[model samples]
Target chain A: MRSDFVRREVATGLRRNVTMTVAMVLTTAISLALLGTGMLAVRTIDSTESLYADRLEIQVALTQDVSAADQDCSQPICSGLKKTLENSPLVESVTFESQQEAYTRFQQLFAGQSIADVARPQSLPATLRVKLADQQTGADAVRQAMNGQVGVRTIIDQRDVVGKLFDFLGGVRNVTFALALVQAVAALLLISNTVQVSAYTRRVEVGVMRLVGATRWYTQLPFLIEAVLTGVVGAVLAGVGLVVAKFAFIDDLLAGIAQNGVIPPITIYDVLETSIWLLPIGAAIAGVTGYVTLRLYVKV
Target chain B: MVAMATVATHEGSSLPLTLGDGRGGIRERSPRRAEGAGRTRVAGAAPGTVPTVIRLERVTKMYKTSTRPALDRVSVSVDKGEFVFLIGPSGSGKSTFLRLLLREDVPTRGRITVADLDVAKLPRRRVPRLRQRIGVVFQDFRLLPNRTVGGNVAFALEVIGKPQATIARVVPEVLELVGLEGKADRMPHELSGGEQQRVAIARAFVNRPLVLLADEPTGNLDPDTSQDIMLLLERINRTGTTVVMATHDHSIVDSMRRRVVELDLGQVVRDESRGVYGVGR
Candidate 1:
């Protein structure tokens, strides 16, 4: 068939069923946008993992009775504890955080909050942050050895905290995927309905083509192409939606908290990568849904 | 995806189908599978001469729900460039016979060949190529409602992948041939019943099909307008395209004095060359 004629037919068919076509496009766009968010959530989880993978800091807080009088460690027990950590092969390195250092860090970490103004140098306790060299087994050995040490207070396992972070990210991913699933179903149904209505309205035209010996493919080509075309348009719309969302919402939230370094910011690249991933998925979802529906539902 | 793509290639498949006899009995046959099997000449053909356009041998079609056969042991053939009329009552199997020709339905028993292709065996995908060689006219003209008369005619070529230049050149010639030259821009609803039928006939003949089938082409028109439509069909026939028209217009058949094949109760009761209508009466 002449390509111009096919284009004309596609345009005419789309125009003939404007309401259904619009609904199909909108549903496809929404579904793809949700899918993009899901993909980005997965990427964010990956980024968070890489950022914290080797940075699990094990903070050992000093008890008040052991060093309440002075920030300097002239006491034999404190110096002995420091030497024990230095001599241990499991500990990658140990850095002492003084009462003054902890207070300054706290003030900087909570600068925007009211509690930072009241915090003083003597109010915070000093501690050693242990970075395990052989993270797979060293952290367990150090925690076991340090559990009942003299002048020691409490051992804080950063790995457990990071595990909580991963759990939260995993929850976000699950929610995103669940919402995407619902939207995908909606998109598929809308696409099928659109094709069915288009086929029904053009029944006369299809019958004539069949009588004239046009192939089932030939008679059905315009509708299929229209379906694929609608899907691509929806994908582009979803890509745009992702970009706007990253700039208007995610970027703003990250900028506010990014200064304190509380959480690693998800870059625009994540949004772009999600959009890039969504284009083919969006097209595939629409195109495959259309083909299957035509095969099973529409006789032509 | 592979199956759908195979439809585009349209190579024959060895799909085993259930065969049945005329008396409402079913049987299985390990029928010939003609995939990559060279095109056998339409049954009973000598090469180089004008081929047999349509052939049906012992064909039977019995609807599953119906007690009696729709077409029982019916066999007929039309050579290239012949004009034949099918006459029958409402349930006398006229439409069923035409539908079989179109491969819209298959025969329960025996074989049907159109343009030398075993229509009963023709894969569903290749039906369009068979139909491209045949044109059909109906009682109610099936023109696309929005398109102008020229677009309706050009539509046949468009579906078959004809180029624009060819469509541009041929559409006007066909419109002129159908004597709707000036009304090329008019839509189907804008034209009268006869004019709409003319547009339909124009579309059918635009591709210059080897055979034309009309199912009550004049069923809706008045006598005088019906006479005009018949004249157009007769003119089409004179151009060496075989015409097979099914109609209950006894008066028109009588006036034409052409070959008439009459059907009664799913069987061909009368076939005469250059015979008038109701000659059996």
Candidate 2:
């Protein structure tokens, strides 16, 4: 009930076992940092998926006859396919690219590549770029509508390539979580061990206190507070570590992909948001571990 | 069964001899009265006479590891402000008797009443409150090595949430009473064995408890040092605190000539007023 006494006891307990206290703090910090990184990776993956989802579209390539014959999609065969696609309920909008325009875009897509030299205007086929209202079922509906029609060649779903990128990011998240779990287990052992050692070192004083009318809870409270204090300090260290990692590690590692807008950047805000959660999570783990250790191994 | 007959004869014949205060009638009814709710009331005492502060009725303790009970059907009482000695061999349950009074261990059977609180019936959460009314000292002194003498004494009040003002005011008073006023700033290791015991006594007595239970207070000290400590305890006993001490030291008990209860094999063999150690054995 006395704050000063509790504070004094906590300070003494932590100071008496300085090495164990430091070990506990460092372990908790590393584990919580890994957990924060895993959470941020998940956020990044979600944002990247939404960013590409807005621009996702299906490409419909026409036959070579259509490419050679149609100049501006003014011919009946070319214009008819564009009109049908635009009229479908699944299609949000349709734009046609002639062979010459497709060739220009292809050169821009691979400007510095050796393959650009082999492509001519007649080599690239005329195509219709179709934006869908819904990504999940619209691509199938568009492919079914144009199946085996005259002047139609193939339908390309862009999501197939983008899905691979997401899979890689998901893998990163899973790996981070798995590593975090392992580190968390290490941190748990350290916390419990520290509590036990601290309790053991102070057994004489605690026994005296109990004999002199101090409650069991009163004697054990200092140990609990010491654990929680270490946990909170570790959380603060983990938060700082996350912010530094964003700039020092994550940004540099993700530079190329983030520049191309293939994945969202790991911002300071994202790291901070994830870091805020580590405080409570760290405290809960330390508190529960302290309580259980005392109950099971140490009487006081 | 032989011990039970010995106990009956001892109670019937020796009970009257020990009633030195002329309260023999009330003393005779105590075992029956302890069984009921009237244990706290001194039925026929003079207007200002002290009431019974501790009572044990047919108390028995059986530790599972051993067939012999640690204590067997032990019955005794001590009045307020009285100094009583529990003398026995090492394994004759002297320490167990003090431990049961402190509620550190429970008797397997029978009732113990200390400061009007039934030991068995007290709730676990309320045990601390019961202990607050009693002070305990051990042979080892059990002082916190890291804390100063003042800090160790103040610790007793601090853990119970006493304010800083009260701790500052009362710690020095207790230290002075125990004759360690100037040694408050010294650590436990800095003091001699006798002085260290004084610090432990200061800590225990700082709370002004109703009863003081000492388990071999002089077990670790020299003869001269033990005598000094006994004098200090006697001084404290004069302040109206009941003192129950268990000891293996015969000289101190024989010299003090206080009421002595002798135990042998977990049974009370003799309880005498102004008794000496090993008087008839």
DockQ of each: 0.56, 0.69
lDDT of 2 by residue, A31-148 (tens): 9999998899799888998899879889899999988999788999989999999888888999888899998999998999999999899888989999998788899999898889
In candidate 1 the C-alpha lDDT for residue A99 amounts to: 81
Candidate 1: Cα lDDT at B19: 23
Evaluated at residue A270, the lDDT of candidate 2 is 86
Q: Which segments of candidate 1 are over 4 A away from where they belong?
A: A60-91, A96-104, A107-128, A133-153, B1-50, B269-279
- DockQ for the candidate 1 complex? 0.56
- Give residue A195's error in model 2 in angstroms: 1.2
* Candidate 2 global CA lDDT score: 0.84
DockQ of 2: 0.69
Evaluated with lDDT, which candidate comes out highest?
A: 2
TM-score of 2: 0.85
Question: What lDDT does the true structure give each of the candidates?
Answer: 0.79, 0.84
lDDT, candidate 2, B174-268, per-residue tens: 99999998899999999999999999999999999989999899999999999999999988887778899999898998888666777888887
Q: Positional deviation of A41 in candidate 2, in angstroms?
A: 0.5
Q: CAPRI band of model 2?
A: medium
